[model samples]
Target: MDPGQGKKAVLNRSCRTNTSFLSFLCVYTIMKWALLSVWDKTGIVDLAQALIQHNFSIMSSGGTGTALAGAGIPFTEVSRYTGFPEMMDGRVKTLHPKVHGGLLGRRQIDDAIMAKYGINRIGLLVVNLYPFERMSRESLPLEKLIEYIDVGGPAMIRAAAKNFKDVAVVVDPSDYPEVVKTLSSNVGFSHEQRLIFAKKAFARTAAYDAAISNHLSNLDNTFPPILTLQFTNGRMLRYGENPHQQAAVYGTTGIAGAEPLQGKQMSYNNYLDVNAGTALLAEFEEPTAVIVKHNNPCGVSVGTDILEAYLSARDVDPVSAYGSVVSLNREVDKKLAEAIDSTFVEVVAAPSFTRDAVEAMRKKENMRVLILPERNTSDEVRTIDGGVLVQRTPAYQENWQVITDRDPTTDEMSALRIAWKVCKHTKSNTIIFADQKRTLGIGAGQMSRVDSAKIAIEKACAPLAGSAVASDAFLPFPDTLEVAAKAGATALVQPGGSIRDDEVIKAANRLNVAMVFTGVRYFRH
Candidate 1:
């Protein structure tokens, strides 16, 4: 048999044997040809076997061909079929015109041209890009990383996806079962199924390119020339901030991906409060508890045990703690679960919950209980009217310079650290008063700094005397210091960069208040 004639000779012979072109066209459409080139070999052998059973010829190359041969599943080597050798260490294997022409060829329209070029029609394309993302995380050199960029893979994927009307592209291994099922049912992929697969294939290639772009951009600049953001696995939410607005959550990690074990559907407000609470809770290493309401921390405390921390944190502002999101650094046990069940909390996030604790919390069936894993900090993004804003704080440490005549005592310094951590996460124009282990008062999101100080004093659950105060920003005037001193705050911490710093320091000395400067400002607006 002449390899050059191949399937084209069969069609030509049928036409010469008094057979109509329409009959030959029917035979060509039913004779499926699948091209399989993948980095992930999972389920590839099984899929190839199924394709062969369905009377579909398979073409593969490199490791895919090796695996298929090892599994005793007969397949045509891509290089053999293309009449081109796999040169450049297999990099130049699938970039030939035959591969693209097969994937992108139109039925009946390009049949003559395809036959002339010996390009077989590819009905199915199964491809996955190289492990660029996984290798990017590894300690590989630039030259090695470039090899994983996957040039031919993405090109072939785009071609097949663009010709979805004639080709079915599969990039995800999870969809292999569906393809097998469809073939077994003797019904080829429907238009809708092909379109869906094509959309997913394009998205996979786009995300792959985005990863490469973002990584290279980091080496040259802080951000890329053109930012491309992609998130997958979108879960539709019941509603947005209100019932009238539509919303959906995307991404598969961190708070955006968390799903409740057993509870009512999470709302937009619930996700916001939980995100804020978990972020603040991450700052503590001890058994700490953080309670958030309306995107603000109502109470925060560190104790010897999680139960004590939860109790003290809740007591800091019991009124605001109602129906709030609670986050803890430690695991949730039965005792803590029972204690949480005593209140009307909306969500509880922790590393883990014991079996007994889950049973105890069953009393409140509507409460959302989820595991909050450690989350790495990424760029902060916010949307405005015209576009969006992106900001990131480089790694830093607090200066913690004592600027007043009197330095903070040991207990005051400990309280100052706690207050500073809470203040960093709280809203701007905020004042946080804390004792050694727990916050005594919190004033956040006020218009004026002096008003914030006054509100903190007014909201104190415990005596403000012998407590430390932390302001999110520098004190522009001595009036806030005077107000805090008059309220019995013995020590204060603020970012000292205001023009009136000298006057504020003098007032601190005059009022016998200890003040420290932390050259970093934490303004959360």
Candidate 2:
């Protein structure tokens, strides 16, 4: 071939390749058609109305179709287009070619195949899934729970998502209005908006299927097989556990179970301290009062009367107890009100309060006194990355018994029980010293177990001599037992765990003090 002819030929080939690539790019950029289906109808009517105004053909299945029809909107049935009925009690709807072909097709490239098969183009897909979490929580029958598992919804969503360059997908109800507004303002959603929506749709579908995957997959060692996570909208609090840091209250999915009555808005730290205070309250069968600060119990006491208990709990750390969050298992009476009059309290949460008692507490206008409406115990939560950790709250010890050489005299055992119960609510390594109806001293948030015991003895003042002591965990060394005994600790309760547990018992024996192993540790941290 001649050199000049070769050059011309090369230029022609380059132009043809450029034109082909440009055509592909243009076709990929242009999208047509839309599919709409949803289980939650909260804002579906408005979304459908907007789509109809925009001249986008709507296709829906089963209840979603019924919902659109009831709202006086017209939509194409997936069954009619696919030539298949929604078999098996409506579970088989939308799992068909007409629905998927529209969602997955590239309008320009797939026209030949679509034309031959008579399939429609789908440019947008908007879908929301059934509430399996809500269903399971309601104690739905096994069959009903299984039925709520969404099939067609996810398939269409995934198809549209995969073809995002030519398709837009919206999975959350919250995104409906925004997507509608953007699409309404322009001929189509911008590439930026489509990209954002596509990412969100995939995430929603992933989380949804993860829930299902965890559900059906059998567990060999994993007790739950599937871990369920439910989060209620978090409320911005006045502050975190501290006023300096910003905080928010992320409520549990068990929202109907929350019961806080008549209190100032809880801060970040307020809720933590209050939960500790309340969990301590659950431990006592009798009327009890517990005051806590920085996740540690400053004072706690069970008494025949509320005022006495409050006074005793307050006495444990009068200085640290200032502005403490307080909780009571029973109603707060006038006497308890009088005891708290001298100090600043962040909150006083109780099941109930007398009219006069409420009036008395109101004297301190700045004080937050809340009444929790729920009388029963429930789970407490701790959040971690990507998932949450939960546990059934340790309830009142109904079966607590003395299991040691020094059997607690009925009276001493009662006091020890109250002290140990409250100790768990304190941040660990924890120690509490009390006698009869009031906390004499408290030591909380220590690094070493023995140090906590020493702090409790120092705080107890003279009361340390005869007061009973509660150790959140066992005396790892016999020295802690010796220290408590020297400080005048008489009766003791602890969850024993040291290898030389017998040595600690021997130390208690030598001191002539009674010791009981609770077999439960109350570690708040």
Candidate 3:
């Protein structure tokens, strides 16, 4: 096998059987031996201690080995076991004979693999992949992204996972305590337990591989289907959208386990509403806040600060804000916390929160505070009746195009672009009211465009007197634009290809409102 093309791997035949459930954790009292190599070390120290307590010998590579040594815990270095020092800018570790053979070999000595590589033992492998997703999302240069791919880690995990009967693999930190419990119950975890873990290991590896493929491949490469179909063993809600339906809360990659810091056990519909609110709020850069009800935003606002934004959005329609799922682009602060605490909000999602803010929120015994590790609006997905709707993302892409007979003035052009961007994010039959680089109001999903315009006006009741308006599609009639002008909108934006483009433009001219035609239509449906 060529080193340049990745090492060839072989697995010994299965020769082990499983044990019946001993306890919630099939505690194995003894550990024979193990190998560990990881990138993120969340509970590695405790895990290593647990293995040591069980009388297991350890072999590790690089920083992990060094860490164990610093703690006065003895370990066989990967170099000492494989007889090959980690080289190539520290890229070639644990890729040699002894490592793979041990994980992939059955207890009964197999001559085929040994004859090819002269190798023998790894009973268990604990590996967590390099931070590829974290690296890709960073504001890093190309070189950093190149350094994050884990070559040896995934390969070894796959090899051990393929020979599951002979190996125990742990890819997630959360699995450590359970693994330790099972090991302690029985002298050793049986073949079945290992096999179950092996399946999970392979799935984890597949997810990592798919993320890499999608990130590297360009649009024209005809990318493969890669959406995370992850749903951890979270709580089953009382019911779904209504008592007549059924539903469950499914989480995505990186985020695991449902731990609502403050709230009653979340109902299925509550989770859905919270997810929609948080996802929509994440779309803007400003100190934006969104309140969602039944997968639609009842109110949204952007301001220089979070408190003002949340208050403005909340004040839009207090009647609708009741039990609303609220989300903010910025950290939840004291003022915002106080405002939220004084209400009947069901959930509050934000990137983070101050200590005082959290304490304030705790006053509401049933309000949930979800701290989103990362603001994730770059990519999105949704499933429909026939199939899923996939795209680069519908995430408010900046508009740089202009289509109008008379060129808009510089100020009008900037406002048009901003308003257009916000309108694109609002639901179809959309109308967005904007001024001063912030969204004043948004009306979405109306049957008639005129009604949508009216909703936007109603939402921005006070500010409606002097803001600009944006529409996702052509009005097809003059009435809509005339209403927008009547609402004191200073400018208008639409796709502008309707046969009655003349009528719309005429209304714009009559109202002295600067107008633009994007030529591209953006319908959320």
Weakest ten-residue segment in model 1 by summed lDDT: 1-10
Say which candidate scores most in lDDT. 1
Clashes of each: 0, 7, 13
Best by TM-score: 1
Per-residue lDDT of 1-525 in model 2, one digit per residue for the tens? 111233334544554578767445434433245677788877888888888787666777677778888988877777776888889888787887777887787766886676557566777788888887567667666676888888888888889888888788898888888878876787677778788888887877887877666555522433365565544455787776556888766654222234344456656677767766776677677877888888777777777777767776777678888989888887877877767767998888888888888888878877777766454444455789987776765445533545456677776776686677668777788887877777777888899978988888777744577778888877888887788888888888888777988888887777888888867776777
lDDT of 1 by residue, 1-525 (tens): 122335555566665575457455536543568999999999999999999899888889999989998999877888888888999998899998999999999987998788777688899999998999999999799999999999999999999999999999999999999999999999799999999999999999999999999999987798777777899989899999888999998878889889999789888899999999988888899999999999999999999999999999999999999999999989999999999999999999999999999999989999999898658677888889987799988888878899999999999999999999999999989999999999999999999999988888998999888899999999999999899888888999999999999999999999999999999999999
TM-score of 3: 0.69
Residue-level lDDT of model 3, residues 245-318, one tens digit each, is 87666555322344567777777767667666666665577788888876677777777788888887887667
Q: List the residue pairs that clash in candidate 1.
A: none
Clashes of 2: 7
Ranking by TM-score: 1, 2, 3
In candidate 3, how many Å is residue 130 off? 5.3
lDDT value, candidate 1, whole model: 0.91
Q: For candidate 2, give the lDDT.
A: 0.74
* The 10-residue segment with the lowest total lDDT in model 2: 1-10
